[model samples]
Target: MQLLEYISFLLLSSVKFFFFYPVFITKEDYNFLEAMTFGLTAGFIGSSTFIFFGDVMYQFFHRLALKKAITHPPKEKKQRSIKHRRLIVKLRDDYGLWGIAFLAPILITIPLACILATRFYHNKGKILGHFMIAIAFWSALIYIFKSSLIHLIS
Candidate 1:
């Protein structure tokens, strides 16, 4: 029964890791490391999926919506200034994959990354690789901080 309970906890943690971080961590039963792992994994997977297949998924949904004749309210168009374009180009040239992976999750979303990858380079593998690297860096930072906090408290 204890083993069953542990398995149930792990499963729940994994699912929570894939969807929401704060929700998983708020569970009183989960220890620090368990919660961190769940949060990191969830963030990684969510970010990766957004970076790799976001555009395709968006298109699929868009097509479905069109078929269903569901009208999306039109969005206001924001003009991109020359400076903004220059900044984007600089980021693309300087950071390449790593820049996009790191900044996208912070500034945009994985889906936006996917759109950028497809629209700019048309390379899904490269986008995924960059996103995973970014995830690794972010996860490591989170893990270290969490461990330090636990150590300090204990």
Candidate 2:
């Protein structure tokens, strides 16, 4: 029964809501090491899968974008374009990949974060390392809040 619960926890962690689900799984009592292992492993797997194959996904999206562009020509830009671009640049400059990595596992979900990181940042190794750190960090944090999370659930 416990093994089945562990497997279920792993699958649930991989899909989304990586943090809270483990607490949900072990609602009555928390097993710190077990939750950490399963959650971290699932996060790593998701991050690896997306980051490694990002190129293919990128190309696919790029081609689709090109097709859309060719089919429908773009309209004239609004005067606010420059300000918007500046804001984006400023945010990117200030936060960049690390911010995305730190928030990814807990907030944005792993696959989207990995894709965004790979799209903007050129370093696969660094991205993966950041993801590993983020997963570990969030996993530990979630486990630390096991009692509260379980209480909220039940």
Candidate 3:
């Protein structure tokens, strides 16, 4: 049950965001292997699903936005969107997909990363593959370090 909870949490939270949960669970359950397994599996599955879904939703919303713009031209200021677009453009210009892939697992939530990646990159599979690799690497490193720290403390 605890393992289920941990995986479910990882599914919703970013791999980095909930990376320490496994440590806590290990402390309580003394099941480092199980916790690590759940965490890693959850990170992979959750991030993959999120990335794919984000791509689909982005396409849908993009089409919807175009249609809306064509039919009902808005007069409202898109300050927030403009700001976000600028930020994304800056990130794209500065770092590109590799940077986003490397940083996403640790620096940002998976869904947000997926959305950004999808917006910038045309290859969904490639982006998702990079995200999975990042997640796996981070999950393993975090689990090892945290579990070892817990062991040392105990």
RMSD of each: 6.0, 4.0, 3.8
TM-score of each: 0.56, 0.73, 0.67
lDDT for model 3, please. Answer: 0.70
Model 1 root mean square deviation, Cα atoms: 6.0
Worst 10 residues of 2 by lDDT: 21-30
**What value does the lDDT take at residue 87 in candidate 2?**
60
How high is the lDDT of residue 150 in model 1? 67
Q: In order, what lDDT does every prediction score? A: 0.59, 0.76, 0.70
Task: Give one digit per residue, the lDDT tens place, for model 1 in 1-154.
Answer: 9767545544443233323343334444356566656545655556556556667787898798787665665365346766777887787899876777687545655556656666666666777667667655654555566567767988
Best by TM-score: 2
Task: Quote model 2's TM-score.
Answer: 0.73
> Which residue ranges in model 3 land beyond 4 Å of their true spot?
1-7, 13-36, 59-83
Give candidate 1 regions above 4 Å deviation.
Answer: 1-23, 26-40, 57-83, 150-154
What's the residue-level lDDT of 143 in candidate 1? 54
Extract clashing residue pairs from model 1: 17-42, 50-110
Query: Measured by TM-score, how close is model 1 to the native structure?
Result: 0.56
